[model samples]
Target chain A: MSTAKISLRGVHKAFGANSVLNGIDMDIAEGTVVSLIGPSGSGKSTLLRCINLLEPIDDGEILLDGIDISLPGFDANPVRRRIGMVFQNFNLFPHMSVEDNITLSPVRTLGVNKSLARAKAVELLERFGLADKVNAFPDQLSGGQQQRVAIIRALAIEPEVLLLDEITSSLDPELVGEVLDVVRELKTSGMTLVLATHEMGFARDISDLVCVLYSGHIIEQGLPSQVFSAPQSERAQQFLERIIRAGRL
Target chain B: MGTITGRRAAYERARKRRSTVVATVSSLAVVTAIVVLVPKMPRWDRVHESFFNGERFAHSLPRLLDAFVLDIKIFAWSMPAIVVLALLVAITRNSRSAALFPLRILTIAYTDIMRGVPIILWIYLIGFGVPGLGIERPWNSPLIWGSVALVLTYASYIAEVFRAGIESVHESQRAAARSLGLSSWQTMRHVVLPQAIRRVIPPLMNDMVSLQKDVALVSLIGPIEILRQAGIDKSKFANFTPYIAAAAIFLLITIPLTRTTDWLIERERRRTTGTRIS
Candidate 1:
């Protein structure tokens, strides 16, 4: 698959002996969508965070384009600049307008000029159907709109890969579809995507590879259709059973 | 329906006017009673001959006011320095970098020592000790020393206020900024300080009120500010009216500032909580 845009080898992380990612190993091919599905506290979010270098790994290597990124003393800013992360809680800068929130990193860290950054912000806002809300403060928007703004803000950085951490889980039941629609569009445009999510239906429909994590271990991973139909491990089967009982699958 | 609503509005306006009239009359009566009764008392005969003498008030007004300008000058000179120093100290203390550990300890010690002793003591120590040491130029001028003492004294208090503001910003904001590839300093300058500084304005203004009054303390160092001028007048005329006049001028300056700060605090509370006052 043209060598992988990014690869994780022996990624281990823990918070004071409560291990989160225990010797994780995976490789993400370019332009492919990978989904990490598991029960809560099963290390899905932590793994995504480690990939972005938001959380430091205890031991292992995360190589972006065959260059080791997770090594200690490697400045994470350059690597982080190429990886965009959308948090679950929106985390839109409350003090800034929607346009400013989208353009801040581009202008500040990227050295993009004011006029171009603003133009890019305007174009993205229009693409997301948020043109009317450009000057609006984040507190003035709904949970769904805020989340969309966050995703668009991440997109503004022009990152090589996008990481989303439960982007739709915080939205209202009716508001969830709008955010997912944006993700679907991203996939159709051949953007590489990794997400930790609770949406089993969406995961099955979109992901190229689905990894089932359980208690800090990736016990099962393969094509979504195969894993959904036939989970090999007892824990994965039980996890899927819970999803079924909850009517989420 | 229009007539009824218009009539209700008129009635509300009338009621408000009546309440205002009642408040005005009550206040005027209090003033009028003091004016009439105090003059009638025997003590007024003695007090007025000395203190309320129109001629003395007229004579002292310009002289005392001229000296008061030095206090204003000291306050003006010290304000910008105080703000900049407080931000520096607060940032130093709050930094997570191990390289700043010594600076953090120093900042903590500065705040602790400056806050523990009375502000007057700092003024005394700096204003008296520095010049007594026979230092040159800025350190030697009592005027400069008084200003330096005020800035040092007030910056410590203001630094604590700033630290509280910085800490009050949610940790998630920092996380979000860093996730976007903003460095630690960039995140602080953009995402954190703007919000924190806004949150702190009311408290900072509260400290400003304290500062405005404390500028009077510089009089002890021999700058011939309002209080010192008043002291001279008291000794010359054998009356306490100069003290009262000095206090009145201080109230004129500080009371409005204190009131404005109170209003700002209320507005800040409403804005932060996303509430409407109506």
Candidate 2:
């Protein structure tokens, strides 16, 4: 049997009286694409954040490669290093250049040599069509370019699973395509990817397994063809219907 | 048509130059008139003897300059001490970790009490009172006590400055850093502090100007800086000419510092906004 790469069991999260993730359970196998799709306040982003331990789950275990990492006092850095994350705001360090941003974690944390790290960073930038923007600061780049650089910085660490939380939500419509193209390219290369996205059409197109989260619950999940074309749950059906009515799907 | 336009532009440039020259001449004339008129006023001669006596000013210059060296020494020594202390206090004050809770309260109180009390009072308490308290070796030297007082007092203000810089960095930056698997301290050092320090440089330099001026306050503890030298000259000659010289020296340092702060603030604004006038 092929074991799961990242798994969660009964994960629960809350903020004061407001419950964000009531119960989340999923086992993402290696070399597969998982898309979490839901409207605002449904905990899609929260689920993605929990994978990298950005948000502590109130209860339950987050297992990465069959080992529980949710225990208190666990050194999160090792696990975090193994899982790459990209944010909606493309939070690249504004004070650092794209090259430095890509090199920082690898050089400082991974004990990579300065020249090796720089060489690797240059390679990634060139591969991603950002060769000219290496010396450019985050503020100097367009939103799409900044997000692409952020993705490259995440990949620089050579993470096992890439978690993208609404990575293209903040981009303009035209700019969204550029970032989506990068994700599509990553998927074709057999990367284990989990993404929370509002781009329904793109999600429908890219996801191997589409999960519809509703009010912190996974209301429906299956092959993208099954879920998108024939959702079983009423909540999932209505949600997709609403998106269709809004001309989003 | 081209000649007409070119001629008009030349005429406009000439007019601008003429107005600038006229403004300069008028400013000089006004200043000269004020100086000449003020000197002729009743009791101006006595006032001149008290504050502008050339002989006393020239004599006090060398003494004041020599004493000013001590002020620079105290200033140089106190800076690193205050910077290190303030940064620790600010980090402690800003920490959300439960273990830092007690330290947070202590730093808050320290900043509050130190800032609330006057620097002169610290000079009095540490510089004089510490010695009387029989605190042994380090307390005995006025230089040490005086520098300690300046450091303690200035750290509170500088800590607040550092804390502001630390907090002004957007929360998303921290989240991004942490999400990278960077520990909190590493994130702060690599990501947050760089931005924060850049933003606060102008304010920090302004604080340094305050520190530079307050370096004269060590004079109360018997280190004869420029101000103290003026007091010595005043008593010896029964005139205030030396005080005028000291004031001029103070202005000499302060004016450039103020201009530097303005220039730095402007440059920071332009850099952050990604806009510049060529």
Candidate 3:
């Protein structure tokens, strides 16, 4: 059986005159965490979005378990069903409570029974230490709590791969560590994760592989130690130096 | 410190005196104008005779109640239809596909034309002209024509309201829903519409109050509504009191709705402030 959970070859995307993802190649193995880190406008979030076809690629082939997902007539829905995403803004449905927000996709898209979805939601909430917040609205929760709920909401579908797009960026400085702790737990549990983040320390600590993206291309990629400690490319070395100088790493 | 407190007290007293003077002047002017106009007004003697001394009041009262009933019936039936059509129009307007352009244009044209021409003109054209085209009424009731007119005109306005509401929902919400594997329709129904509809409730309630008042315009099309009954009574007795009574009834119906509109506005304001603080 094939081991690659996701594979993207020469994936390209452009918005009018601005090319966002240019000739990108990536492979994510099963049950591994790969962190994509870069400065703003580096297209890390776009790449994460493109995997679920949330942002359509201008060119390339994306494969899941060696099955061509980018091919015409391929059902995007089932592909999306297999992949879950968490947003930077914690896009919890404001009209719903935390429990309802978590159960919405399972009940509506997957045809899961409400009672079953609710049960699963409660389980996930308990696991995330958010059992007490089940009936609270999204607006009633802190940023850290909301992001935790978003993660659990994505996991309710039991997806093979989880894509996180800067999930802690909108958080308060003091609240950032709480959300990263949940991510760290997911990493230990062997969830296949593709995370785009600016959290250098968290990426170094939790990621199996870290890929440095710059100007719509992967400038360097390797084990976190290789990329952070002994980057082969001058660009990657300079990027790390900038992060260290900024007192982030 | 004592001087500062005295100055603050003086400022407060001055502000109160200014406001009180303005209020008294306005009240005196309004009262003086009413006193001057009261004697020149038409006599209530003939009106009292018709309303209290005869069958005119009895006949007109039932007719007015029937008209009220018809108005309520028409409004109830047409509101749902308007909501559905407005939603459809709103969706088509927001569609990006090339195939939807024609539909978008047609909807825009429909809204523009209907909004530009008065509702009464549309009533006359549809009520009088459509029958000439061999489209027989299902039941020969003026209620149907008046309702058709209200729905057609109000649907256009409501469509714009729906579109504005939908547009007001943050674009980030749409992107977030899509990334979560929701289809376009699913995103709209589950995420966008709920928030959008909440934002629009106050305006929609305002429109409904206006709609209740506009129902009186249907009297122009030979319906024996409250206003029409008042006209008949006035012609018989040469008294304007029945018309005043009709005006009072209209106010009675609309005042509660106006209060509801105010309450909704206040609730929405509180929600917005609450969301911001959170």
Candidate 4:
């Protein structure tokens, strides 16, 4: 059995009695793509954010590498460094160039020298097919290009796990494939990825394990082929039917 | 069809004729008014005499130069104090702690009070009140007192300028930095403050220009700056030439600075737009 890179048990989050995430329990295994598919506001993004401690869970244990992250006096920054996150809106620093954006956290947090950081940034940018646009600012890049840069930025610190929150949802139809290509490449490279996406086809193609979230609960989870081809739960079937009928799956 | 075309032509002609009549009447009226009013206006002889007279110019030059140097010294002392105080005020104003709320409120009240009161009054209060209290006036110099008054008064305004600049930084910029695993201070120092300071530069330069002009107001406390020297020369020479010469000198110093500031504002505006585009 593969080791779990991230484990969540009895995770609960409430925003002023709304109860956005209620009792989420899941395990993301190392070196595999696990896609979380759900409707909007189904706590998919919240779960991903919790793993990075961006939104602190109200009640739950987030175990990263079999160690509880919420334990007293635990350093959240190092944990955050280990768990990279790509935001839905890209969240690229507008004032910084693509190279600076990628190199920033590494230099500031890890005390990496500028020359080393720059070389690393160039390598990542080149791998991401953005070598020529290194000096360009965030606003200069297209949505797909910016999102790719954001992924490279997160990956620059050599994170053990990466969380992608609806990364392709903001991209144009034609631009979506370019971003998905990067994710596809990451999956092939044996990176542990927890992706929250509405793109059913991309999820089915790239994910090894697929989990369907409904009303803050993982209603069904299994192999991507099993979940996509034959869902046992009525909720999963209904969601898949709705998504297919809407021509989105 | 011919009649309709003729009617259109007539309408166009009438419109052109009406505009011509209006323009002609306005110019004729202005010329007539100028002709009637020219001699009734104040004589240029006073202005001419002030410029040509050597005795008055020479008498005022010494006092004007002295006053100018005094003004420069006062500004030199006050500027650093204002920059540091304003930065402190900005940080306090932006702090999230509950304890910082009262400090923020007090800062706002202080700025408001300083802006409302006259600087001359502040100078007198500092100069005379300290002597009355047996403090022996630390510097015992009007230059020092004037500078103190200027710094206190302008620091309040500068603080507001800085606070506005800091607040103008997009909230998303801060969030982006935080998400990168940077602490609050790290995000502020690295990302937010750099952008904020850039945005505030042109306005800060404007404030500096205002400060230069405001230095003259210190003459009320008897610092013997350019304005003070001009006043003394005017009285001694029994002519307004010295005052005119001082005014000329002020213009000579300020006009270039004003042009430079305008150019800077335009350049910054272009850079901001360029950044937005990219």
Candidate 5:
């Protein structure tokens, strides 16, 4: 836990009467990818949101670099600055051009100079094979291109941890590869990543640790090879069996 | 295929021509009926003498146009004040901090009270009531107070428009902004307001058009704007022709503004859809 880049302990969240994340505890070691896999409405997205501080926790501590960030009166802004998030909907600012979208946070939040931020944006866009799209608006780009730009926008701030919430879930089946390719590149570059995703094969390929959530709890957490192959808890086994039955694993 | 397409083109052209002819004929009929039937009424002579006397209209036209300049002056100056104050009020109302809760409540009450009162009553209270404090010359001038009334009342309405625009933005966008580490104020300034202001321009222009006409209400407090000048001309000439002239003057300005608003709205619609109306 001391070496963990992110650690969650007894985290709980609920909306009205519906409890979402119940007593979650996990440690994400530095420079490793952690994949959260679960059925829909199983609190995967809620857990990612709580970690990013987009959603406030009802109880417990989320520690970043040994600091208890979820304690009351802790400023979430500075913590969020250290954690970048990409959404399923690719919530890129529609009114801004791709260049502007990528540069906005760096320029405004980090006080980076405009020209310098823009240079970083151009470099990221070029690396993603989207150099021609710098002047284009989000609506003008394909879903794949927009999601890649979203990743670049997050990377522009150079956050220590990146949280991806089903980043490729909204892309066309054919367009999914382009986005996943970026995630593959990120893995090689050694950024600590926590992603809530439904792509079972991609999760198996890239994640050092896989956590299978059911209802609102971590039902299983282990190496992907162990969880994907061996018989384990009844619920985890049932989940894998269903995935195999559906030809998704 | 060529012949078929040619025949379809001819059919389309014929359809357009037929519609145009029908529209023109119907419009002509309405105009002709108004012109011919209006004079046939029993009191047409008296009504014509009072309301449509061309000589009286000509006599009052120059004074009404001159007084209309005051309306324009008041409008031009009041508009900036209204827009600035309304944006401030709207942003104030959007504050979410527990510390700003009282300030937020104050803004809500401000908008409620300002919007609940009629513009005329606002003009009377701020215009007459303020001047009644006997502040002496230029400071107590009704023009200044009347413009202030216009600013306050219109700011409330525009602030509500701005609030609606702000709320129309999806919560996801806020989440996206916050996730990027933008402070709430930064989120609004950079991500939210740019979109909100664009979406609300048509409504804001509509409000401006209404304000252009409502400037006349200021005449009730004491400034001899076009409406008041028309009243003065009415008593002197014992005819209502000046009122028509005043209406004509207002239409002259508002018609172009209304058309420009429509053009802007259509352009925005086309922009969002990325399609031509045709």
Candidate 6:
């Protein structure tokens, strides 16, 4: 518990009249992978965004490295530097070259030297098998390649926690494997990842813990095996049954 | 199969030839009608002598061209000033800082006032009213004040253009930048402004074409730019050809510029994806 990389306590978030996240609590330990799987609009993305401080929660305490980052007027930049997010839409900067996109945050935010940042970018691109695309713009790359580069861009900042929000949901069926492969690689590297995903099989294979959310509540969470094989909550059972029927589980 | 392909190619060629012939014949008929029928009007000689007199055209061309250099200089200096001021105002208006709320209001007021007033009235007020303040020589010159009026007026219009460009950038782009730990200002400078400026170049160029022609407006206050010089020539020669010569020079520059703007707009349209007409 002391080593929990991210801790959310009694979190609640609402947009105007519709509540998205409600009275939720979770602790993600260091160097473990957690997957949040739920129906669309079930607060998975909202929970991830709250942890990253992209959206301010209506009421909660989000602790990152033992600091309450959800406090009023908390400077989120330094916090965000330690937590990376990969979006559902693969929001890569279209005007920038792949290499530049990866190097920008490190150079601008971290004050890393330009040449060193670029060298690191090249190494990361090479590791991702995107060495030849270092100078290509995002529009020139396929959806899979762009997502891979986005992962590389997130990695360049060397974040302690990575929050991925349905990163593979937008890719073509044939292209989803490439990005999932990168996630699998990350899982083996001991990075703490919190993913909101629809890829049930991949989530089951990689996640140490699986959380089932319904109606903005984490109805069940436990070891992936326990959650997948025997969901305790009725809502979790119904949700998993639908996923099973879709051949996703 | 080869015979079928050859026949298709021949058919395509015939269609192209037919369209080209029709276009050329229609254009020629319009030109011939204007050429033959226009002079048949009773006062054609008077109209031609006043407007298209060969001697006056040649006589006024050199002086008008010389005066036009002044117009070019005014346009050149005013454009950069307008661009810089407009960008600042646009960014100020777009800022989300609570501390900058006053600045945002100021920018809104500035743009509203500048745009609400007619450019001519501004030229008169700043051009005459400022000098009437008993300012010293050189600084009091109408050219300096007149150029300032043009800059202020045009910057307001251009600022809105820039603001439109800024707003057009997707909010997700800003979120992505912010999530990367870049400060809001850094996000704007690197991620937003570059894209915004690129998107607005076509409209910005259109504004510049208008700005170029409106440089002639300064002649109303003073500074013997082409239009003013044309007046001088007309009074001296007692003919209106100088005005026509001045117009020709403006058309020579503006037409090409207008065409270039269209080309850029077309190229930009082709580069992006979305709903497109066939």
lDDT of each: 0.90, 0.89, 0.84, 0.84, 0.92, 0.93
Clashes of each: 0, 0, 0, 3, 0, 0
lDDT of 6: 0.93
Could you give the CAPRI-style class of model 2? medium
Question: What lDDT score is found at residue B16 in candidate 3?
Answer: 95
Candidate 2, A1-249: lDDT as tens digits: 228998889999998999999889888999999999987899998888888888888999999888899888888898999999999999999888788899989988899998999999999888889999888878878899999999999999999999999999899899999899899999988899999988899998999899999999999999999999999999999999999999998
Candidate 5 chain B weakest ten by summed lDDT: B269-278
CAPRI class of candidate 6: medium
lDDT of 2 at A53: 89
Question: Model 2, B173-257: lDDT tens per residue?
Answer: 9888877778888898899888888878878887888899899998898777888888988998899999888888778778887
| Candidate 4, A159-181: lDDT as tens digits | 88999999998999999999999
DockQ (0 to 1) for model 2 = 0.57
Model 5: per-residue Cα lDDT over B1-278, one tens digit each: 99999999999999999999999999999999999999999999999999999999999999999999999999999999999999999988987778988889989999999999999999999999998998989899999999999999999999999998998888889998999899999999999988899899988988999999999899998889999999999999899999999999998998999898788777755544433445
Poorest stretch of ten by lDDT in candidate 5 chain A: A227-236
Which regions of candidate 3 fall more than 4 Å away from where they truly are?
Answer: B1-62, B97-99, B137-141, B261-278
Each candidate: RMSD to true structure? 3.4, 3.3, 4.6, 6.8, 2.3, 2.5
Chain B TM-score for the candidates in order: 0.83, 0.85, 0.76, 0.76, 0.91, 0.90
Model 1 chain B worst lDDT run, 10 consecutive residues: B269-278
Q: Residue A52 deviation, candidate 1, in Å? A: 1.6
Worst 10 residues of 1 chain A by lDDT: A1-10
lDDT of 3 by residue, B1-278 (tens): 99999999999999999999999999999999887776466984553565554455555666667667766776688888888888898888977668789999999999999999988898887766555566556754566777788888988999899899999999888876776667778889999998888888878877887887787777787766677777887887776656666766777877888797778777755543325542
Residue lDDT tens for model 1, A29-58:
999999999999999999999998988899
* Candidate 2 stretches greater than 4 Å from native: B1-42, B133-139, B261-273, B276-278
Write model 5 residue lDDT over A1-249, tens digit each, in one string. 487999999999999999999999999998999999988999999999999888889999999999999888889888888999999999998888889999999999999999999999999888889999898878778899989999999999899999999999999999999999999999999999999998899999999999999988999999999988884889889888888899987
Task: List the pairs of residues colliding in candidate 6.
Answer: none
Off by over 4 Å in 5: B1-25, B268-278
Tell how far residue A225 is off in model 4, in angstroms.
2.4
What is the lDDT for A160 in model 6? 93
Better of 4 and 5 by lDDT: 5
